[model samples]
Target: MEEQRPCLNKAEKGCEGPVEGRPSYAGTGTLIWRCTAHDNKAYEAAQETRTRYPDSSTPPGWFDPAAAGERWDDEY
Candidate 1:
Protein backbone atom coordinates (compact mmCIF):
# COMPACT_ATOMS: atom_id res chain seq x y z
CA MET A 1 0.00 0.00 0.00
CA GLU A 2 2.81 2.32 0.93
CA GLU A 3 4.28 1.71 -2.48
CA GLN A 4 1.02 2.85 -4.09
CA ARG A 5 1.17 6.19 -2.37
CA PRO A 6 2.84 9.35 -3.75
CA CYS A 7 0.35 8.99 -6.59
CA LEU A 8 -2.84 6.99 -6.58
CA ASN A 9 -5.03 7.50 -9.61
CA LYS A 10 -8.67 7.80 -8.67
CA ALA A 11 -10.55 4.64 -9.61
CA GLU A 12 -13.54 5.00 -11.87
CA LYS A 13 -16.94 4.90 -10.20
CA GLY A 14 -19.36 2.03 -10.90
CA CYS A 15 -16.47 -0.06 -12.15
CA GLU A 16 -18.30 -3.37 -11.98
CA GLY A 17 -16.98 -6.93 -12.01
CA PRO A 18 -14.30 -8.44 -9.80
CA VAL A 19 -13.81 -7.46 -6.18
CA GLU A 20 -12.21 -4.28 -7.49
CA GLY A 21 -11.55 -2.77 -10.89
CA ARG A 22 -8.22 -2.69 -12.66
CA PRO A 23 -6.09 0.43 -12.38
CA SER A 24 -3.34 1.36 -14.76
CA TYR A 25 0.17 1.70 -13.44
CA ALA A 26 2.48 4.64 -13.99
CA GLY A 27 5.27 4.33 -16.53
CA THR A 28 4.11 0.78 -17.19
CA GLY A 29 1.88 0.80 -20.24
CA THR A 30 1.64 -2.96 -20.56
CA LEU A 31 0.57 -3.76 -16.98
CA ILE A 32 -2.67 -2.84 -15.23
CA TRP A 33 -4.03 -2.97 -11.62
CA ARG A 34 -6.85 -4.87 -9.93
CA CYS A 35 -7.86 -3.54 -6.52
CA THR A 36 -9.25 -5.84 -3.79
CA ALA A 37 -9.39 -5.52 0.00
CA HIS A 38 -9.01 -8.64 2.09
CA ASP A 39 -10.76 -8.08 5.43
CA ASN A 40 -9.51 -4.49 5.54
CA LYS A 41 -6.03 -5.80 6.21
CA ALA A 42 -3.98 -3.30 4.26
CA TYR A 43 -0.73 -4.76 5.51
CA GLU A 44 -1.16 -8.40 6.44
CA ALA A 45 -3.45 -10.89 4.74
CA ALA A 46 -3.41 -14.57 3.97
CA GLN A 47 -4.93 -14.43 0.50
CA GLU A 48 -6.38 -11.77 -1.78
CA THR A 49 -8.00 -12.17 -5.15
CA ARG A 50 -7.50 -9.79 -8.09
CA THR A 51 -9.25 -9.15 -11.38
CA ARG A 52 -7.93 -7.27 -14.34
CA TYR A 53 -10.08 -4.49 -15.77
CA PRO A 54 -10.28 -4.36 -19.53
CA ASP A 55 -12.34 -2.43 -22.03
CA SER A 56 -15.95 -3.51 -22.28
CA SER A 57 -17.59 -4.73 -25.44
CA THR A 58 -18.98 -2.09 -27.77
CA PRO A 59 -21.10 -4.35 -29.99
CA PRO A 60 -20.89 -7.51 -32.06
CA GLY A 61 -17.39 -8.79 -32.87
CA TRP A 62 -15.94 -6.47 -30.26
CA PHE A 63 -13.18 -7.51 -27.91
CA ASP A 64 -14.54 -7.15 -24.43
CA PRO A 65 -12.03 -7.38 -21.69
CA ALA A 66 -14.85 -8.11 -19.29
CA ALA A 67 -15.91 -11.08 -21.35
CA ALA A 68 -12.33 -11.65 -22.37
CA GLY A 69 -13.58 -10.70 -25.84
CA GLU A 70 -15.94 -13.66 -26.25
CA ARG A 71 -18.49 -13.43 -29.04
CA TRP A 72 -22.09 -12.64 -28.13
CA ASP A 73 -23.96 -15.78 -29.07
CA ASP A 74 -27.16 -16.23 -27.10
CA GLU A 75 -27.90 -19.66 -28.55
CA TYR A 76 -26.47 -21.40 -25.50
Candidate 2:
Protein backbone atom coordinates (compact mmCIF):
# COMPACT_ATOMS: atom_id res chain seq x y z
CA MET A 1 0.00 0.00 0.00
CA GLU A 2 1.16 3.51 -0.71
CA GLU A 3 1.43 5.74 2.36
CA GLN A 4 1.04 9.49 2.63
CA ARG A 5 3.82 12.01 3.22
CA PRO A 6 5.35 12.93 6.62
CA CYS A 7 5.24 16.69 6.51
CA LEU A 8 5.40 18.77 9.69
CA ASN A 9 2.65 21.22 8.95
CA LYS A 10 -0.81 21.92 10.33
CA ALA A 11 -1.98 18.74 8.58
CA GLU A 12 0.25 16.64 10.77
CA LYS A 13 -1.63 14.32 13.10
CA GLY A 14 -2.34 15.50 16.63
CA CYS A 15 -1.29 18.93 15.45
CA GLU A 16 -3.67 21.47 16.88
CA GLY A 17 -3.27 25.20 17.25
CA PRO A 18 -1.13 27.34 14.92
CA VAL A 19 1.53 25.27 13.27
CA GLU A 20 5.01 26.68 12.77
CA GLY A 21 5.56 25.96 9.07
CA ARG A 22 1.94 25.68 8.01
CA PRO A 23 0.28 28.46 6.09
CA SER A 24 -2.09 30.10 8.57
CA TYR A 25 -2.48 33.77 7.61
CA ALA A 26 -4.20 33.46 4.20
CA GLY A 27 -4.59 30.90 1.45
CA THR A 28 -7.03 28.45 -0.16
CA GLY A 29 -6.98 26.45 3.08
CA THR A 30 -6.10 23.15 1.53
CA LEU A 31 -5.69 20.19 3.82
CA ILE A 32 -2.34 18.36 3.56
CA TRP A 33 -2.07 14.69 4.26
CA ARG A 34 0.24 13.18 6.87
CA CYS A 35 2.34 10.12 6.30
CA THR A 36 5.28 8.38 7.93
CA ALA A 37 7.04 6.99 4.86
CA HIS A 38 7.53 10.23 2.94
CA ASP A 39 7.29 13.98 3.44
CA ASN A 40 5.51 16.24 1.00
CA LYS A 41 6.67 19.41 2.67
CA ALA A 42 7.69 20.87 -0.68
CA TYR A 43 4.04 21.69 -1.44
CA GLU A 44 3.75 23.97 1.56
CA ALA A 45 7.13 25.53 0.94
CA ALA A 46 6.31 26.22 -2.70
CA GLN A 47 2.99 27.76 -1.69
CA GLU A 48 4.68 30.01 0.78
CA THR A 49 7.28 31.02 -1.76
CA ARG A 50 4.60 31.75 -4.30
CA THR A 51 2.67 33.87 -1.85
CA ARG A 52 5.74 35.70 -0.74
CA TYR A 53 7.06 36.19 -4.24
CA PRO A 54 4.24 36.53 -6.72
CA ASP A 55 5.37 36.19 -10.33
CA SER A 56 4.24 38.25 -13.27
CA SER A 57 3.42 36.64 -16.58
CA THR A 58 4.66 39.63 -18.48
CA PRO A 59 7.52 37.94 -20.24
CA PRO A 60 9.71 34.98 -20.98
CA GLY A 61 9.99 33.29 -17.64
CA TRP A 62 6.75 34.54 -16.14
CA PHE A 63 8.65 34.66 -12.88
CA ASP A 64 10.30 37.98 -13.58
CA PRO A 65 8.89 40.81 -11.53
CA ALA A 66 9.93 43.63 -13.86
CA ALA A 67 8.93 42.03 -17.11
CA ALA A 68 7.34 44.23 -19.75
CA GLY A 69 4.95 42.70 -22.22
CA GLU A 70 2.48 44.07 -24.74
CA ARG A 71 1.32 46.51 -22.08
CA TRP A 72 3.13 47.96 -19.08
CA ASP A 73 1.00 46.11 -16.59
CA ASP A 74 0.66 42.90 -18.56
CA GLU A 75 0.78 40.57 -15.63
CA TYR A 76 -0.93 37.27 -15.34
Candidate 3:
Protein backbone atom coordinates (compact mmCIF):
# COMPACT_ATOMS: atom_id res chain seq x y z
CA MET A 1 0.00 0.00 0.00
CA GLU A 2 1.16 3.52 -0.73
CA GLU A 3 2.11 5.55 2.28
CA GLN A 4 -0.31 8.36 2.89
CA ARG A 5 1.07 11.88 2.93
CA PRO A 6 -0.29 14.11 5.64
CA CYS A 7 -1.81 17.33 4.51
CA LEU A 8 0.53 20.28 4.90
CA ASN A 9 -2.47 22.37 5.83
CA LYS A 10 -2.34 20.80 9.24
CA ALA A 11 0.54 23.08 10.04
CA GLU A 12 -1.59 26.09 9.26
CA LYS A 13 -5.05 25.16 10.38
CA GLY A 14 -5.10 21.78 12.15
CA CYS A 15 -6.61 19.91 9.21
CA GLU A 16 -6.39 16.15 9.74
CA GLY A 17 -7.12 15.02 6.18
CA PRO A 18 -4.48 13.16 4.21
CA VAL A 19 -3.33 14.34 0.83
CA GLU A 20 -5.72 13.06 -1.81
CA GLY A 21 -4.10 13.99 -5.13
CA ARG A 22 -1.08 15.49 -6.83
CA PRO A 23 0.74 18.14 -4.84
CA SER A 24 1.09 21.76 -5.81
CA TYR A 25 4.21 23.91 -6.01
CA ALA A 26 4.45 27.20 -4.28
CA GLY A 27 5.86 30.41 -5.73
CA THR A 28 9.11 29.66 -3.92
CA GLY A 29 9.11 26.16 -5.36
CA THR A 30 7.95 24.58 -2.13
CA LEU A 31 5.84 21.48 -2.49
CA ILE A 32 2.44 21.88 -0.89
CA TRP A 33 0.37 18.80 -0.11
CA ARG A 34 -3.09 19.59 1.05
CA CYS A 35 -6.43 17.83 1.39
CA THR A 36 -9.39 19.00 -0.72
CA ALA A 37 -10.79 21.16 2.05
CA HIS A 38 -7.58 23.01 2.79
CA ASP A 39 -6.62 23.19 -0.84
CA ASN A 40 -9.72 25.20 -1.69
CA LYS A 41 -9.18 27.46 1.28
CA ALA A 42 -5.58 28.13 0.37
CA TYR A 43 -6.48 28.83 -3.25
CA GLU A 44 -9.20 31.24 -2.32
CA ALA A 45 -7.01 33.03 0.20
CA ALA A 46 -4.21 33.35 -2.31
CA GLN A 47 -6.57 34.77 -4.90
CA GLU A 48 -7.92 37.33 -2.47
CA THR A 49 -4.43 38.35 -1.45
CA ARG A 50 -3.41 38.78 -5.07
CA THR A 51 -6.48 40.81 -5.90
CA ARG A 52 -5.97 43.09 -2.91
CA TYR A 53 -2.22 43.48 -3.28
CA PRO A 54 -1.34 43.11 -6.94
CA ASP A 55 1.96 44.91 -6.56
CA SER A 56 3.12 43.27 -3.37
CA SER A 57 6.69 42.08 -3.46
CA THR A 58 5.98 38.82 -1.73
CA PRO A 59 3.68 36.53 -3.63
CA PRO A 60 1.53 33.88 -1.97
CA GLY A 61 2.47 30.22 -2.15
CA TRP A 62 0.06 29.56 -5.00
CA PHE A 63 1.53 32.38 -7.06
CA ASP A 64 3.63 31.26 -10.02
CA PRO A 65 6.58 33.53 -10.62
CA ALA A 66 7.02 32.52 -14.23
CA ALA A 67 3.41 33.22 -15.04
CA ALA A 68 3.77 36.68 -13.54
CA GLY A 69 6.84 37.60 -15.60
CA GLU A 70 9.18 36.86 -12.69
CA ARG A 71 12.17 34.56 -12.90
CA TRP A 72 13.03 31.99 -10.24
CA ASP A 73 16.69 31.10 -10.02
CA ASP A 74 17.95 28.39 -7.74
CA GLU A 75 21.32 30.12 -7.45
CA TYR A 76 19.77 33.12 -5.78
CA RMSD, predictions in order: 13.0, 12.1, 7.3
Arrange candidates by TM-score, highest first: which order?
3, 2, 1
lDDT: worst 10-residue window of model 2: 63-72
Relative to the true structure, how large is the alpha-carbon lDDT of every model? 0.27, 0.35, 0.56
lDDT pick, better of 2 and 3: 3
Any runs in candidate 3 off by more than 4 Å, and if so which? 1-3, 11-26, 58-76
1-76 per-residue lDDT for model 3 (tens digits): 9877777556565564557644332255555667777777766755676578766665456766433223333333
Give the number of the best model, judged by TM-score: 3
Q: What is the full ranking by lDDT, best candidate first?
A: 3, 2, 1
How much is the lDDT of residue 13 in candidate 3?
56
- Model 2: residues with Cα > 4 Å off, grouped in runs: 1-39, 56-76
Pairs with backbone N, CA or C atoms under 3 Å apart (clashes), candidate 3: none
Selected candidate, larger TM-score, 2 vs 3: 3
Model 1, position 25: C-alpha lDDT score: 23
Q: Give the top-scoring candidate (lDDT).
A: 3
Where is the poorest 10-residue window by lDDT in model 1? 42-51
TM-score of each: 0.19, 0.24, 0.53
User: What would you estimate as the lDDT of candidate 3?
Assistant: 0.56
Candidate 2 Cα deviation (angstroms), residue 51 = 0.3
Candidate 2's displacement at residue 29, Å, is: 24
